[model samples]
Target chain A: MSDNSNNNAYWAANMRIIKIFLVIWFICSFGFGILLRPLLSGIAVGGTDLGFWFAQQGSILVFLVLIFAYASRMNKLDREHGVDE
Target chain B: MDQFTLNLLIVGATFALYIGIAIWARAGTTSEFYAAGRGVNPVMNGMATGADWMSAASFISMAGIIAFGGYDTSAYLMGWTGGYVLLAMLLAPYLRKFGKYTVPEFIGDRFYSGSARMVAVICLIVASVTYVIGQMTGVGVAFSRFLEVSNATGLYIGAGIVFLYAVLGGMKGITYTQVAQYVVLIIAYTIPAVFISLQLTGNPIPALGLFSEHTASGQPLLTTLEGLLSDLGFATYTEQHDTTLNMFLFTVSLMIGTAGLPHVIVRFFTVPTVKDARSSAGWALVFIALLYLTAPAVGAMARLNLITTFYPNGTTEAPLSLEEIQNNEALDWVRNWEKTGLLKFDDKNGDGNIAYVANGEANELTVNRDIIVLANPEIAQLPGWVIALVAAGGLAAALSTAAGLLMAIASAVSHDLIKGQLNPNISEKGELLAARIAMGVAIAVATYLGLNPPGFAAQTVALAFGLAAASIFPALMMGIFSKRINNKGAVAGMVAGLIVTIVYIFLHKGWFFIPGTNSFTDADPLLLSIKSTSFGAVGALVNFIVAYLVSNATDDVPADVQELVESIRIPRGAGSAVDH
Candidate 1:
């Protein structure tokens, strides 16, 4: 394949990964912290509802995991696509 | 040693360690001075970034804010940490690939205009200088409280210490010293928290302690806290009271602002490869999480501890008498902070008792929540050394962040504004000298403002984030993602975002934070849907839309630049990119 086609394919793959990770990110912060909070109300942690946990602590943990997961996976993808430095 | 002496000794030793590191790792070249020669290890860099990112506001005041604000203030915790996700995903790796020394360099190159770079440098300096003032003020407050010095004297001392290290070592020294500061601060923060956690919840881990049962109440920690707060006429700790729209916008604004901060973006430039940049962000988040996760627990538990101390029997009983507060040496911490005017209690209603009921009507005395974290060890009847360590930790947090911000300001002035754009013929030695001069001037300005802070430390921090979000975030995002965004569009977006955010902040706050000139309250912001805190995200959206609309009206990006944007979009060919 030509470099232009290769570049197009690579950009497409990168966006795909970013989109997936972002979905999880949205779920944890917006979903768990706000919209889905009522659903999580029954699942209490400590004295507070699960939603509060996500708001203060749980979402932050998930954010760290999401970033690391995206980064390492992208590194592997880079090598696979002959884009590794 | 006496308690005071012991406190002084520990704090002094930590400062000595920082100075020693500054001496050993001093930067030898511009590259080392600005970006640590792009060879910092991921884990070490992460720790250093953690120190750089977690300012005094995070270490000393964040928990206190959460304790008082309850569920409404979860925005601070979420807004701050959530931005890292945006950083790792949208900004860090690509900027690393650009292989630039400063944020303005990337902006200038991508726009193919020196004018664009100059605009970015102005934004960078304005945002960074405003941010550093908060750190310097925090340092002064911490020093005055612990060292028994006046605020002005403390400011000078703080400025001197920052000058010694930041001027000598640059980014290279700052990075290593930050790692040491991180250890000192985290240990100082967690030890007292662990003691309190174990005492309250029978849990050694504070994060878990927040979810565990309160030993005295025999109820889960959060439930007990909520019940106690309501009983004391305060809002429930877990219930949201702020407007939902405001919350959403505020979170988004903070996320973009974090992504846009020049000091933070520049940290990625220290990594050798794009992969390292990506991984280092993960590591940095991990280090930050160590503090971020512990903060709410500390906030909740400290509130509980303080309430218990006041109502020794329970909220059903009479509050602590004024005599108890005034005469009890165990409560010396309260007296200590009161002297600084950060903590004050007025005997409103002429009541003889010190009742800390939180209802607007029932609460007679105004209490600054910033005192809670600073006074926690003392409230818990912990050893005097613990109190001293907390003081040192607060100072470390402030100074580390100040150093980082000063370095960012200096590099933008000397490297991007002077060498890259204005004086291309300047020698490297001359440039380095210019950088040093800029750092010194930045510190002096910060110290001067810190001696007479216009607002509280945390409020000033919000302004910094707002500026970064409005100006830098939009430009960088457009630079890499939108091929059609011309230099005109990018510059226009930044200026629009910047002016709107700054004017809004000025209107709500003072004009340029000069005090006594604000025309609006935060409750009645300029736009119906926008709070000043949340306007950064709004400005960012406006930036995107304006850039797009304007760019479409103009000619398309040159083909070569289109290809460059495409190259940056992919993860491919990232690992081999050299830092320099």
Candidate 2:
């Protein structure tokens, strides 16, 4: 029963990390890229506003980082939880 | 070799490679057929998924869409890629842990009802079939242009090739072929962009070049593009022209729709473990970003190139004369595409010069922007082999996606419908045979539709995404997240979503999209301030609310079923939990 409890705790921690990273991911793309475009109108990147950059290029770059971060962290989590393949 | 022969040879060789791989990887068992025995590596699966997800619209038409619509169309870029984040966070890992062969399988098991499964199956079919028709039409367009064949003939040829591989190899075959396709497509796409980038901005990287200074105008690339386009009465390339509310809803809808697509979700099932599935989605996005990052650049640069081609002295000067356009070999692509009836230009008002203006009312020249990507190499005076390679690449994009969609359809028929619900006792061998037969029939139907597309390629794809968003997305999400969603509730939600979305689309587009029956468009949608394109997200929301309300009114879910939901929630021990 203790082992099962520990496993559940481990899974919960992993989900917590995913949720946090996903929030960042969501903000970068949907927030900065779309909804917050007007707010980001003052900050310019190249010829366009920061929000435009976020929509076309910046959000995609951040997505790459988020994914890799999740992968590396989750792998470590898997090992700690004794669930590593 | 001549351009025609080179195109045939390159396309032929690629088709042969796909066929060879299909035969070698031919699935012998149901497990191999559906999920390739779940042995695919994260990286390989990522590449295959990238190829599967990047349809002809991404490869051939996206840049053109952006080129014309400018910053207003950034929704396409954001909406398409934003969905990957949703998939990674909300869907991928849990679904992978659920360990189902199809999306409907999860719905059925999670809700514990055959009727729910049937509803999910119907949704999947409608979305997949509609999606596959678009892909088939893309294949036809690519083949017809490059091979100088009729669209119908090209579609038949494409159907024959897809039937060869998809029917033979199933998921196992399609996975490996898709990897090859990713390589061909990325190379085909990036090489020309790199060349154009260097030519226009002196930056080797297309993505960077998009922001770099335009060598000709001595201004920031995007700024110059915006100025030139606005001068010609086009929307600014970097300015927001679409209504903010519509853009927000459209992007959200696309993200949800992407997460819910059965074909894409099923790709995750091929990974060996739940954790791998999570990372695989990341890797898939990484591969996809390589092109997504470059597409906007291609769109901006291609538009600039096209403008400069006509207005050599900038938009302030008179446009290129007819003799100049006809005599220039660099502009031969325009003439070539004109022959196929895909590209057209009329010297209206009997002017010797072609006025390339974006004003819908005043512009006499009508150029199908779809030709821009297809004719980019020719427009820029690239080599014959590069042009031929583009042909092969476009075909790869179209064919790979078509094969994936057909496989998804076939599996839904064989696994979810026949074996799981109808037969239950059918042998694995019989099931595999049924899958192949279903695939053959699906291909035949798609080919027939391709021969006579109800609408243009991009328009049909929008409908496909709409259907997926409205029906499948809601049912799948509610099934996993809301345990109280009873079988009846889930079924009711899916049917409601499907009917509403389809009826709305039909009313706006046409009944069965028969072309003459449509009453409205993006300008005058049925609902208050809602376009047909944005209706899918609304439909999905309605599905969720209805499901929740109905489920709340019903008896509580069985305790054991709740435990199953708990099992799916935890990532730990899921790898070992797979039923052997």
Candidate 3:
């Protein structure tokens, strides 16, 4: 691929993955954590329901994973495109 | 030793250690002063960033807010930590690739206009100064509670120490000191939490302990908590109290604002490269999550412990007598907090017993939520040393964040305003002198504002987040995301966003945050039924609209600025930022 097309391809791929991750972020925090909390109230975890767990603890853990996943994957993308510093 | 002496010794030693680090890591160059020579390790940067991010509000009052507000307060936890995903994915790597000394420097370059940079500086200073006041007040409270000194006295002492280290070593000293602070504070925070968790639920991890069954009731902890709270006429532990739209908007505002704060944003500049900036954010969140996860547990467990202390047999049993409240060992935390006058008791019916309930008429005990974390060790009957350590931790949190804000303020004046805008030919020595002088000025201003603090002291952190979300965040995000936005669009957007958010805040809060100046109270806010804290998200929407709508009429960014955006995005050839 030409340099222009290659860079475009890389960016397109990155954005696609970012879009997917953003949905996960939304679901974990704003979705299950807040808006849909009542829906999951019946399904109990240790004490509270799944939504309460997601709101307080699970979202943060998911956030942690999302960041590391983004970083490692982006680094891999950079190497594939000969952009590695 | 007495608790007072122990508090003094531990706090005193921590200060000496910070000063010693400041002296050893003293910055001789502007790069060192501003960006710590861009050589910090990812893990260390993460730790420093964690310490830099969690202020006295998080360390001292977060649990208190959560403990009182219950699950509704999860917004603070989710709001604060959730922003990191935005930072790491959207902002940090690009800013690191742009390789600048300061946040406004990026704005100035991206817009190719000095006026745009000036607007950013205003947004930064407003949010940061308001935020700093919260830290100063937190310092004052920690000092007053532990040292038995007045709040104002503690604030001045804290400011003086910050001025010394910040003016001397700059970001270099701050980085190492914050690392040490992270260690002290995390330990101080977690020890009491672990003890309390083990005490209540037979689970050592506070987060898991929250889910474990309460040993006394042999029921799940939250279920038991809901029962006790209902008996007292308070909101249940697991139900939502705030309106869904308000909660949703408020969380969005805090998340965006946490990502946008200039002090937090500038920390990424100290890392080595784009990759490290991304990784450091993850590490930073990991360190921060250690506290955020534990905070809710601390809130719930402490509430459980407190309520159970009052009603030993159950909610059906007779409450503690006034004499028992005064004499009981578990009640010592209440008495100690009573000295601060934040905890109060009155037998209104002449019943003589402490009739504690949520009933407006008969409730005799009035306890401020801010006392929860400060009094946690005492509530759990942890040792005196742990109490002293918490005092040190509160100081560490307050001072580290203050130092970070002072640096942000100083660099904006010396680097962006003076060096970049006014005197392009200024020498390194002259710049260093200006930076130190700027540090002095910033401290004086922050301390003055802190002393005569605005009405938003309790929610000042919220105010800061709102301003950031409404103004700087949109401008920065658009500058990278859209090539069509030129200087006029960016400037208009920032000014419009900032004015709208601040006006909304001032309308509910008094103008200039003076108590009587507010036209409306939070109980009855104007427009869309939104609270002042939630308006930032709306303001952010306004910013994007004005920017795009204005940009349609205005010229596109020049070719060089467009290329700069493209370059920042790729992140392949990232290198250490050197002064132009």
Candidate 4:
């Protein structure tokens, strides 16, 4: 990471990963759980629809996975870009 | 072996454990005092963060809210946990690389203005102080209920315990003590959930039991709950009843606020490196999920249990007669809680049986929402020690969060104000003394407020979150992400965000939360379908818009500040957190 371009490239890659994960975050919580809930009412989990499960339980599980996944991806990106400490 | 002594023994044991940890982990330097010397392991830091984040609200009130609010309150479940994702990806690592001891110090340096630092401090104090008052009151409530003391005595004892540890050990003591607190709270929380889950659904794991069969009715647990609630004229347990827009904004506000809260943010500063900071947040969320996952099951189950207690055969069956309730050993909890004035029953229609229904006039039971979690073990007949453990867990949750908030407040006053401005040449030893003194003062103020709380004590959670989301989060994000945002833009954005959020909250919640001064009520807020709690996201948008416009209209950020921003972007050459 000696040059300005290298730093910029590393940052861009990091942002790309963040944007992708954030999309999943949004879809799982706000979309599937709220706005698009009615579309998923046909699918049942336990006693309620999948949308209800997503709202109460599934969204939280997804958030946990998203964070750990981001951390690993960013760590790998750091080494690939020679930005590892 | 009696319930009161058992409660005293367990509560006493936990307090002794905390004090012992404090003495063992006492800080001798400013580094240790403020950031735990930046030597903490990532996993241990994660556990500490869990206890620091899950306050009395989470341990005590969240399940009750979820039990009654049903699908509408999932906003809280997702919002609080989802914010960890934002913190890890957007904020924590870069802030760790910046290597600062406090949030305002990072703001002060990044924006290159004393005024920006001052604004950050003000925002930090207001949000944290509001937050701490709730924790103090929670501590009082837990102590009074479990220890059989007056609320005032409970608060004083709680304050003295905090002063001993926080004043003596600072962040180092708090970090280790919070780890122990996390273990105690998680165990205390999950043990009864497991028993209830098994009893109700034949599953040992409460989270799994939530989606499993209800053994009594041979239906899914949630489905049975939904059926029971609606049969009794209550909203279905698994359906969304609130408006989509309000729920969306409210969840967004809570997420942003969780990411930006100064107390929670400062926990990341305790870890050794930027990578540790990133992964530590992930670990923290994992710890919190242990309780968060079990909470829904507890809520749904407790609600079901309460309803069935009244209508033993079913909701359609005749309700319990007063004679049955008075004689049954299982109904002992009702009698116990009734002594505290938390549970009450009346024969509104002059019938022999108690009526629990949605209609106001004929309904005969009035239970305070706060007692649900405290009274849960007994509700399930889980035995004496389990109930005692809940008392300890509630205190652990309250005290851990109160310590973290006090740490944030103390550091802001001592590190940002006194060392950074008032007495720049103060010795390190002198600064540590000031920090301890600030902790003492903060604890005193928090105790006072807890005793004579403003009418909005319960409402302050929304205010604290709104202020953090509206003001602090956006400024910190822009400071790291954008080089064009100058000092004037940051200050203008923060003030605009703060004022808009506070004014909007006051419009509905009264001026400074005074009861009678409100112009509009939350039932019919000024904005269409947007409660004051949900206005944080909008305030954040206003902040960004004002900041972008203001930055373009003003002079560009200096060259040095641009370099500073670039350096925080990468994790290379990162070091331990710095004070100056």
DockQ for every prediction shown: 0.72, 0.55, 0.81, 0.83
Given candidate 1, what's the lDDT at residue B478? 87
DockQ of 3: 0.81
Ranking by lDDT: 4, 3, 1, 2
Best by DockQ: 4
lDDT scores of the candidates, listed in order: 0.81, 0.79, 0.84, 0.84
For residues B1-580, write the lDDT of model 1, one tens digit per residue. Answer: 7666877898889988987886667635544644552566789999998998999778877888887777777878888898999899889988887765789988988987788899899889878988888887777777767766666676688788778867875433457788999998999899999999999989999999998988888999888887888788777788887777888888887777889898888888657778888888889889988988999989988888888877888999988777888999887876777776666676677778777787666664454665677788888998888888998899888878887788788889998888887798999899989999999998888777776665567657777888888899999988987788998888888888888888888888777677678898787777775777778878788778888888888877788888778777764455433433
Runs in model 1 deviating more than 4 A are B26-37, B150-153, B168-174, B349-351, B359-364, B427-430, B451-455, B570-580
Worst 10 residues of 4 chain B by lDDT: B453-462
Question: What is the C-alpha lDDT profile of model 2 across B344-439, one tens digit per residue?
Answer: 677786778888897665565676555667788777778888888888888888878877787788889988999888998999899889988888
The docking category that best describes candidate 2 is: medium
Model 4's DockQ?
A: 0.83
Q: Candidate 4 residues B54-106, lDDT tens each?
A: 98778877787788888888887888899999999999999989887789999
Residue B54's lDDT in candidate 3: 93
Fraction of the reference Cα-Cα interface contacts (below 8 Å) that each candidate reproduces: 0.78, 0.52, 0.78, 0.80
Please tell me what DockQ candidate 2 reaches. 0.55
TM-score for each candidate, following the candidate numbering: 0.95, 0.93, 0.95, 0.94
Q: Which segments of model 4 are wrong by more than 4 Å?
A: B26-37, B149-174, B425-459
Compared with the true structure, the alpha-carbon lDDT of candidate 1 equals: 0.81
